[model samples]
Target: MKNLLESPPDKLLTALRDILAAKSIVSPAEIAERIALTDAASPAQGARMVARAWTDPDYRALMLHDGAKAAEAAGIPMRGMPPLGVLADTPDLHHLVVCTLCSCYPRAVLGYPPFWFKSAAYRARAVRDPRGLLAEWGTVLPSHMKLTVVDSTADYRWMVLPLRPAGTEGFTEAQLAALVREGDMIGVTLPIASA
Candidate 1:
């Protein structure tokens, strides 16, 4: 029972571990040491890209033209990592992403995807019927924006830099985070405001 409680899904884990130090399977220090976070380069590139896209129309245009090159222009060095690319959500086409084999994500841009994103249901259903999944995520898209699901592999990762939402003219970066839904970044939602 002690070991079973420590398994994930057991809320008692935190309580027991806190009250009984000896019962703790993993120390805070050990957990911290085991965890691996992205380097500064990752978020730095994402921040730079977001700022450029916000302020520079030409840069956004350049990004839409070519993702990899846009990253280079945005001062992101990508040669060391597997090919980093960007996906622009357009009015005519919506892009959703998945890694069928494993979680191949653009950590440099989007950071870590949610736990659900790396789930088997998401990976399987994303490719099976993307539109249905988007609708389930509260995104109702028009027939115009055709949905395209892209699979990220071990050699490559994917990120969805969704289209800027309407009514957000001149909004600051902090404000934009609110408009940018997790589903939108996951490619399961479009940039449509709630009714």
Candidate 2:
């Protein structure tokens, strides 16, 4: 038999699937459905939610109160996923998210965690020197603002609702979404008015 550990990921997954099937632990159809769901997710889904929240007061309140519901309302699937928490940024405060233990992220909304988000250096620096880390990402905030580092875990994941940029008051939801990036939602960067 080929060594499973040395096999390519595709072969390894096939082998595991065969074993699980033999044991009747899970069905192939279920696995395929999950893979399809994951593949369908992308950062655009999160951007849509952010854009809606930016333009609608009711949506903003709903998002701050229950993030998972807000995401579902925005057309992102939340079933079989952990609860999502949104940290709203304001003039006086900023929020940064990190999974100190592992990369427990809101994949259903944001698609996937960035490589840097899973690095040991990032995890350490995020908690140790958040200001410096943000500065490195060109997200330097004012000295008077409060910066809070929120940890995402298996039980819950966190996303940021960045403050809307000025001079975008007349922008449509789609236009506003165009201005949002994954980094902005991750709190590593801010969304600019000029997309």
**Model 2 lDDT tens row, 33-104:** 899989988888899999999999999999999999999998787899988899999999999999999998
lDDT at residue 158 of model 2 (Cα atoms): 90
Error of 1 at 133 (Å): 1.0
lDDT, candidate 1, 45-158, per-residue tens: 554565567567888777766666777786665555566666777778888889988888776556666788889998898899777877888777798768878998767666
TM-score of structure candidate 1: 0.66
Error of 1 at 27 (Å): 25
Misplaced by over 4 Å in model 2 are 1-3, 6-12, 19-24
Look at candidate 1 and tell me the lDDT of residue 154. 66
Q: Which pairs clash (backbone N, Cα, C closer than 3 Å) in model 1?
A: none
Question: What are the Cα lDDT values of the candidates?
Answer: 0.68, 0.92
TM-score on alpha carbons, each prediction: 0.66, 0.91
Model 2 C-alpha RMSD to native? 1.9
